[model samples]
Target: MTPPPGPPPLPELHWLEQLIERGHPHLQAREMRRIHVPGGPSFPVHAITLGNPDPALPAVGYFGGVHGLERIGAEVVIAFLQNIVTRLAWDTGLHRLLEQVRLVFMPIVNPGGMWAATRANPRGVDLMRNAPIDARERVPYLLGGQRLSAGLPWYRGRLGDPLEAESQALCELVQAELLGRPFSIALDCHSGFGISDRLWFPFAHTREPMPHLAEVQVLKTLFDQSHSHHPYIIEPQSAQYLAHGDLWDHLYLQACENTGRTFLPLTLEMGSWLWVKKNPRQLFSRKGIFNPQIGHRQQRVLRRHLALLDFLARAASSHERWRPPSDDRAQHHAQALAQWFPT
Candidate 1:
């Protein structure tokens, strides 16, 4: 008898497991959930955590591979994790930083989708669109998420049904590891949006600015002051398009439910169109649309985002120092409104 074949094995998953083995004594890897394909093998969803566990301390979460087609996002996160694990051997500064903040990584959130080369999970649900949210404003036909058939892209799972397993895993992880903290920042990476890289904050369901717009603005200001020449269009997700069932938006809302807690989630939308522009042949490859097809280009993409990931961790550890006092928050809000939500 022939056994049913599972999706081809995922390279990212293998590399991540290896890092976990090597990162022992410094990092902890837990299999949060396992999703079994209806007729094939199952895959594990992992949450890698390090640093202080105190809920009073700040934290940062690095997430990637929500959409299976965007393998580069997962690769970027894995590269960063590998860098940290390698440094755990003797980097005094990194070790000290780890003591002050909690850092979590879910580098490959949708392994089944990645292995199958589909944007949606094995059950045909788009994890990003599987949250329970609806747009207050008009959304693009399908890109903004839909309750249509699973055969279509950006399909939100059946209404009134529990979230897809991958979505549930992310939500549960964020609620447990992030929402209860004093402060936390989450960065979810993806690509294939435009020619310029973008850093988007929440309220993807509406154009209205989020309550923590002032805090987000200040963080952007700090980054700009330090990096000086970084190339990223920092803005709210609504500025580009509105979407229904955005997982980050859903999680941010949950964090907001806690009084006195500050949770800022950022989505890194890398611009892969330029890769296609540079190599016209990428237009013909499925991976090329959402990732850098050339070997060197892929490496460069990985290198480019490492600093940003590290910066978020550093910023989270020192958020209290950079976030303004109540007396000054109004000014920050005013500035943010003028720049991002001007009348």
Candidate 2:
């Protein structure tokens, strides 16, 4: 005998909806798109926003789940959102901070992929590699991105097609909320990297440094100064490997079109291998390889990153106070080069 079929179980989306309702009249949630899987249930791409609406105010976007199999990414973002929402009723300092900065969130960018337990979306395209940009230098074969088949890992959508819905939604949200501001930051979280965590900035599509390397160095310095024992390795994505169609590189380039604006995009690639090392049995599950499957371990992961997210919010709110003046900009730039691109 066979069991009856059931609707796809997406607790994250459900929880997100409940969260929006709980945050009624405060945070606004918009459906970016409706993702319809051929045989499975459809999912809504939600973008939640709160804080100042003025373009003059700086903003920070917190994103996750660009690769669906990495549920921990989405969970970390939602945990931070939850932290903010729950504090809204009583945290006067938070309310003041919100008045000065904008916060955008798309905690589950690829819910369809999460439903199917795949790295690629339901269409088999990797959302992270679906942007139109190509690597300026040679990239690792296949892993960098490929058009061979959707059946393969790291499959970019077919050439000449429009960006994937998830990718488009994210790009649109960033352009509308984060770009054009005097200063903005983006943090897209993911897992399944090496034994150590990493904070990667732009130019994943090329070996060349981004125009804002000096600002990146400042941000890294501030973070290090505040959390001396923080468990993150901050550097350019190029420091690891280059890839084609990297969405951040494409978006960062678009942001640079405005000389007056500063957009510092960062990706938090969590070190899932540490979890797998402690509990080697997690290797048997594809999702487990990218998430902390144990109850307490997952809680710890969420707790630790909350501080980083909060710091970004506070940093965006006060970017003017810290960004270098013209007199010191070159000095900062030289310092950044020596540290990251030592001769």
Candidate 3:
């Protein structure tokens, strides 16, 4: 068997490198190269570390494109890196933030799916719903008045287990690098359904909050406060609507159960409708790259969203209290919710 093909170099990738070079002097960016399969693509997962590489500095993991069709998530992660790079060149505050924390980012985890524009990998498995959890069951979906099941878009795979090569690669990376480390937070980006902007936590199998529920609330409050002026962003548990074996649940929840480390995972669901109008191709192409118009609109949103992330990075790095319950919390959360679930 041979290694998987490397991700086709994109114009945006160079832009990201330049941004980091210009904006963040304290941070170091390195690529973690891995073989997707025995004879598959050799994809690179980009890691940007701030402060010391030592375990002392709490780490934050940011990932996008666990679902191949959700290319917008990957683009957003790139945009965030670019903005942070651009901002830090002139901003002392951001520079200080970079000096305090480390951020590990895997912009595109499913290169095979990304290349083909399908939600699942080459084997047809939904990576997001493919964690090693018990609530992993397949259900049928009626889309456009047609029945779709695990064999389709959100297929759980054979016996509701993760069988995709991409899934295995991600699992290996987490165990080798993330587990038992001082990772403070993790954010997985995704899109579809144009639902409200939300922050989803783990334990989708049960409504009961995990032991770190208070920490989850605190992080949610911080996000709400940071985007208070923007008026779009809310906190929604992943299992609120349905239960499944999601990536976050597998990482923070499952990992916590095994290692006893307090790691909080948040799913940042940005509103896709804002970009859908500009990029109609996404609506049609199950595995097609986003149209330029939709891509541009997404870029704008990504820029603003990146600014908020920068603010969060700063706040978290400083170990500042994000509490006191500001009036803007509800409004911003509502605004974000309205964008996806508009009344």
Clashes of each: 0, 0, 13
Write model 3 residue lDDT over 1-343, tens digit each, in one string. Answer: 9635775443344555665576456566666544253355445545565554555555566778787777777777777766656666587876566566666667777766766667776666677767666453332242211113556666666664434566665665565445655446677777764545555666555544455555555555665665666644544453345445565666666567654355666777666665566566656755343322454565566775675556555654554344323464465545444443345
Position 229, candidate 2: lDDT: 97
Instruction: List model 1 lDDT by residue over 104-150, tens digit each.
Output: 99999998898888899998999988889899989999999988799
Error of 2 at 171 (Å): 0.5
lDDT of 2 by residue, 42-100 (tens): 99999999999999999999999899889999999999999999999999999999999
Could you tell which candidate, 2 or 3, scores higher by TM-score?
2
Provide C-alpha RMSD values for all models, in order: 2.3, 2.5, 6.6
For all candidates in order, the CA lDDT equals 0.92, 0.92, 0.59
Cα lDDT over the full model 1: 0.92
On a 0 to 100 scale, what is the lDDT of residue 52 in model 1?
93
RMSD in Å for model 3: 6.6
In candidate 3, stretches whose alpha carbon ends up further than 4 angstroms from where it belongs are 1-42, 87-92, 136-151, 159-163, 172-183, 238-240, 258-260, 277-282, 285-292, 320-343
